[model samples]
Target: MKIKKLIQALPAFVMLTSTGVLANNGYVNFPYPTVISATPSANTQTLSSTEYWEVVRGDELKTGVAISFTGNKSVVLLSPQYSHDMNGQKRAPAVAENAIELHTLQGKASLSATYNRDEMSGYGFAPGSAAVQANKLAGQNATLRLNQKISDDDLYLLHVKESDSPYQLNVESNVMVQEEAALVLHADVTGAKNIKPKLAIQVSAPDGQSIPYHFTNDKLAFDAPLEHVGAREGMYNVVVHSHSMVNGLEVKRSVRLPFVHQRESASVITYSLSEQTAKHVTANVSLNVSQEGRYGVVATLMGYRDGKQIALATSEAAQDFSTSETLPIRFTLPKGATGPYQVNILELKDQTRLQRFVQNELVTQ
Candidate 1:
């Protein structure tokens, strides 16, 4: 983006009057200035001059003073400068800085700036443009402005307006869970009554599969059910699409909603290990099966040194558990010698069922 630059000779009688003043001796400068467009009814106010400068398309600006523009199509170009300190008998020229501060009381603006140092440094909104301290302005109206400190070689562009989008949509819930055999989603929208609104919902699973649903009504409020039996124990993306006719043309907007399905196993199991001795370690395991079933228990003893597994031992058994019944099982690691070892007890039903109990312990012998 090209920025409009304002450059002019400094009049000797010009004085600074704006609140944006550097601590030392500094002033703003305009170089290669150009006015793109402005309305005849627009006006500008400067600190040094009480008279407002009339808005024009090609008017040249004289100093780097703080100015406020009002009315339609009001625009100008400007930059800032600071005086250089003198050393011994030699006097150095003032250094030019690209730090600019802007505040909009009741308008919108778009700003773009190029930074010689870091590209991200030139794009912030603040109240003042000076390098030193500055004051902040307050107002209820929304304002679009840019505050940045740039080198004299960098360029920037700023455009301001006073308008808002004609339509807006807001969702009350971004995340929902499938509960009690059904998943329900809801949303609220505004500024869409006259446009004949339409709603569409799409669900995307983890395996790159998508299911789409379109609503029949144009109501701003929505409550819909998403039925999918295959969605289980993972995250799914629920996208809501809103379409409407604006000025006899169709406009569409979409938002991604978060949906999750979490189903836990029917049983719970816990285990603890006895203190290790020179010859073996013993683990005490407990299981509370909520559902009656035959469950398999596996205990694995593994030795680790320097964070890598060195040796392994396995023991397995099966038992029938009644509903709400507690079962206690014990396993012994028989490897005679060890430095650090881990014991893991896992209980499950066949290979297809989720693990009902998973417990581990670290011990030293």
Candidate 2:
């Protein structure tokens, strides 16, 4: 399929926002950045065949990874996959080294790390320092692997300070995410090549209830059913983190989203509007409500104007329900919006929020 068509065909769950996908449901599909390639100059060697991008705290990372080639090649700039959750757990793993290496350089060179800061205003890589000391890789054809590795939570922008020939680099990264739900939790992590990533997740409720769910490292991802009892009104949070060793480099990923706790008590069974009521610019949306709570209907009123079908307006009305009464919804009839209008129900749900139903529409008399 064509590229544009492919992107259009993606599910609504995918998005490129600060929290990966700006989703409110238990579903998520974060769109990885468009695989764009840079136009290389005649002197630029084939170190990167394609400019790869992935999400790190809503930022796109251009990665060439561990590809090796002859010639000076293009200087490979890297982005990160770092994770730091709430409760201030933002620190590097004891095993991580925030440093770079000049592995197998054929000519003279000076190499150092330049990494990115999360949510910075200017938005670019700054000079990075080893946790214990400042270090740089130098010398000709020498494999000077810095003893300090890059922090997993830090995005990288490594620079080949001065290099005359081809060189190899291996980098590490980290990312973070948080979410909330009461129904189901589903997640998928995809990156690297020929290596299976592992997931570890935790769910917590406002009342100090904690539940742990793990992704089965099978060919298919896993799903965990969530249920919070005592705290039904307060927010519930879920945190997920996944890790993998790609090309001998450690990669960590995380993201954040929201979902709501729902209850079922009402639904729009049918609706009605007479020529007389239509004259008053109103429609009676009939719903089968059980308990007393906010009940509503979301529909577009379709009318005709100038011999063409035109939407008068879309309306959403919610009110306290008692005795299963028909709720009257008001609409602003545009001038010359001649009816028989159609009440097209886009979503119909009972007091049980989110359990929506797709049904037919009603035509005004």
Candidate 3:
């Protein structure tokens, strides 16, 4: 009989020890490792400052505890489950389920907790993780989600809404450019009547030069001179400022665009006067021919006697060339033309003039 009683008591002793039940009604549970410092809200018991302090369940938190983290990491706390009381003869186990206040002074951190089978079924957290904002945890348990900063190349979206405003603004191609390009700014004020809109474009060149253009209409078009842009081959900023007034309310929006100036060598045609006479004048025209294709050349001659305009003649020609080539162009002056005259040469393609040159004097005989 004595041996059987001792065997029955052995099982109860193991259960009490495994559940962290002390003889003096104290219970122990696993503690977090990276908890650098913790201050309890109530001073019921003294906390140890040793490196290996363990926290147990059913501990009465006189006040809420404040925990601090040092690095970019997180911590998870799991509370143990207990069996229900049997026959009103056994007392139910006490468990601590209060919220812990976390303080992240230097780096980022997150906190999570585990739930049992019944609790997990009703909980709506995602499989692995869920992000919850600070304000979203009102009247509920506190769980932290990591906060991160955005990178430089990331795109951000902005939404603007105001009362009684019916205008919208949109911008395209805020950066990057090519040579001989134009910048366009557009505004949409479709159903807005009695509203005044103004657009302004300001350019700051690389060499400390500022150019400003303003328009009262909805569109502001800008085209920078190629020569001026080439001289300052660096970063350029184009700022667009928009203003509107509807029913005594004003709305303003601004955006800055940055781009670099890059240009290639331009194709050119050279003209030289070879021979001249009273009836006609002959000239040699040469092209470097960077690109091989058909080109059109238009030549005009104006005859002047004693510094007075007299006669005007025009001639045009088109030819296909593979490489650099020279051609002789002859312009027939007016009948009985005898005076010094001027010549103008134009390089054209499909009636669009690419370049123009003027030659001063050739005596027509």
Worst 10 residues of 2 by lDDT: 43-52
| Residue pairs that clash (backbone atoms under 3 angstroms), model 3 | 29-56, 41-63, 42-63, 277-365, 278-364, 278-365
Per residue, candidate 1 scores C-alpha lDDT tens digits across 248-298 of 333344455554433333443555666566654544445565555455545
lDDT for 269 in candidate 3 is 57
Segments of candidate 2 deviating more than 4 angstroms: 1-191, 212-232, 275-280, 347-365
Q: After superposition, how far is residue 285 of candidate 3 from its true place, in Å?
A: 1.5
Give me the displacement of residue 298 in model 2, in angstroms.
2.8
Q: What are the models' TM-scores?
A: 0.27, 0.45, 0.29
Candidate 1, which segments miss by more than 4 Å at Cα?
1-166, 172-176, 194-196, 212-234, 247-249, 266-365
lDDT of 2 by residue, 138-236 (tens): 221233333344433444433222122222221221111112322333333333545554655555655647745443422112144444322234545
Residue 171 displacement (Å), model 3: 15
Regions of model 3 farther than 4 Å from truth? 1-243, 248-266, 274-278, 306-311, 339-341, 347-365
Model 1 CA lDDT for position 273 = 60
